[model samples]
Target chain A: MNLLLLHPDQRLDGDRWRLDDRQATHVRSVLKLAEGDHCRAGLLDEGTGQAVIESIKNNEIEISFKVDSKPVFALPLNLLLALPRPKMLKRLLVDAASLGIKNIVLVNAAKVDKSYWQTPNLKGDLLREKLLLGLEQAGDPVMPRLRLAPRFRPFVEDELDQWAGPGRRLVAHPGPFPELPRGLDEPATLAIGPEGGWTPFEVALLEQQGFGCHRFGSRILRVETALPALVGALMRLP
Target chain B: MNLLLLHPDQRLDGDRWRLDDRQATHVRSVLKLAEGDHCRAGLLDEGTGQAVIESIKNNEIEISFKVDSKPVFALPLNLLLALPRPKMLKRLLVDAASLGIKNIVLVNAAKVDKSYWQTPNLKGDLLREKLLLGLEQAGDPVMPRLRLAPRFRPFVEDELDQWAGPGRRLVAHPGPFPELPRGLDEPATLAIGPEGGWTPFEVALLEQQGFGCHRFGSRILRVETALPALVGALMRLP
Candidate 1:
């Protein structure tokens, strides 16, 4: 873990915090820090700073934290993803979090296997756990909001405008099309397809919603690879 | 498989090819093609077109091949990567080829585990197999060149200059450095450090070798995530 992610509930007092369970084990074994040594740390949805080891006890470690008051900035991007397979889903969740995307909506697509919706990996807590790994990986404190849309048509036709807010609406498809437009700090929602990609009708549906389809290149990229690539293509973080 | 990859030696006669083993099984089971069916197929490092199934038998399938003469284009990017863990390596190899990267040099680094060099996945034929999967995934014909450097100092000090010929020489790090400039279709080499990133000494040495380190925001992305993100940040495919 790049940063010691402390939960809001873990605070012992105003400045002191207690760490236990997986984070405790990681600090004890992997970090191998000693008393008085400071490690980079931040609270969930809080700014990063340093935490000094106060004591190493039997079951837990006590530490004192001093963090910057600045809030972690969320990227003005919303990822509208076709639910990938379980293995790829795990990787994407971690990446989406690490990349600081503000919102992710996993919508059903034509090629998305029905079995993917039934996988345990899609469970609420399981999904949260994956996103946590991502946040810790990037040392970011903000948790991204993830929503599921099991029905593709209704979600796009009904809830997309409000969810996407106001910004660039894009669908990333194989290019020979126009280049990705320059990014604005305002919100952008990028829709990526499933394994075989979106059908013509599906593309038209999203197009009708003001989602301009853009191309990265002619070669098809795997969904996991395409997510970060397309994200990088659209914007750069400050 | 998006494209059924065929080997040149699989040709039974002038225009007919016989497919057996894993691919034949895939065409039978996953693709579920019967006699007279056609599938998108390509020869390794050759053009992609169509192959019509002429016959299906007990152990093998017979098909007639017809392919375009156009060569698959390689992205003018060389990836200088620290050897990642085996699992991550497997994913990177596939992605590198799918992204159409021309050259990848896996160099030893202070943070790279020594055991990574000894992995069976790094074996030449095994590496070839992974790249093939990537090629098949993208329906691309060209295979990326993979080289191993077991020593860090010599590889950077001795080989970096010649290896990274006539293009932008860069190292990716956590940044608020500057925005990545627009891309050109010329050769560029990007060096990415290991999981914890390069030590200060190593970064200095690379800096001395004419490598301008750039940043992709403050988020420390995983190597697998960073590779594509940086590659995307550098250049977009034509």
Candidate 2:
């Protein structure tokens, strides 16, 4: 964990904060911090600063913070992704969140397996847990907003206009089309399809919505590999 | 499976070839091919074309081929990587091979665990299996060349000049240095460090060998996530 992320409610009396088992174990074992030692810490969606270990008790670590109140590293792009298998879903969610992508809409596609939507990972706590792990790895305080779109057609036709950040729209498909131009000037909304890729009808549907079709290359990458690659290629890295 | 990959030795008669269990199962269940059906197929490092299914026996499938000779999509970059944990090693080998990276040298660093050098994944057959899976996913016929550098100093001092592809040399370090300048003009050699990153001594040793330090961004991405991201950011995709 790059950052010792503390939730707002974890605040005890005054500047003191209490950490749960997860963060406590990380601090104790990974960071190998002792009483009176300070580790890089942050508040959820608040700011990044330092935390001094005050005490280590049963299942919790008490820390006193010195923080500056502001969010760190919110990515400009919003993602529209086809739900992958359960295992892949876990990895992508964590990776995408770590990349600081501001928003994600996991939508259904013709190539997506019907049972993928039934996974427990779609539930609240499990989903939030993955995002939190990502946030901690990034040392970022802001949580990327996540939404689910189980039905493909209605989501694109009805909700997509409302969903997309105001910018260019693109779809990652099997292509000899133009490359995703580097360093997009505005926030872009990119739609990535599932394993078999979008059907012709699905691609046409997205095209009707102004989602320009493109490919990174002819080599079809796994969704887990493609997201970061596409993200890095689409934006200018700081 | 994107391509039905065949070994040249599998050819049994004038136009007939036999498939092992892996390919036979993929053809029978995944591709659902029957007699007289053709699938996209290729011979190892030889060429890509099509194969016609002749019959399915107990453990093998017989086929006839018409292949065109040439390797597809060898990436114009050589990678100097720090070996990750076993599970991650599996994914990266597959992904890197699939991306068409032509050469990889897995090197050691202070932060790399000694046990990582001892993984069964370091052995020959399992390592080749991962690369073949990646090649099949990409529908590419060429296998990437891989080398191991268990000793850091000797490899960079004695072998690096001969190992490096002639052009710009880079090391992916935590940086405010500069973005990996987009699309290099010639073949390039890029080195990536271990999880906690290269120690200053390691970086300095590399710098002496003309490896310029660079970063993708401020975000600390996983080795798996970072490889594809770095690869995508460094090269212009087709």
Put down candidate 2 lDDT per residue, A85-144, tens digits, no spaces. Answer: 989888898888888887999999998999998888789789888888888888887788
List, residue by residue over B31-95, the lDDT tens digit for candidate 2.
88899999888888788888899988775789998677577567788999988888999999998
Q: What is the lDDT of candidate 2?
A: 0.85
lDDT of 1: 0.84
Task: Give the worst 10-residue stretch by lDDT in candidate 2 chain A.
Answer: A66-75
iRMSD for each candidate structure, in the order shown: 1.5, 1.4
Q: Where does model 2 exceed 4 Å of error?
A: none
**Candidate 1 residue A161 C-alpha distance from true site, Å:** 0.2
Among all candidates shown, the one with the greatest DockQ: 2
Clashing pairs in 2: none
- Judge the docking of candidate 2 as incorrect, acceptable, medium or high: medium
Clashes of each: 2, 0
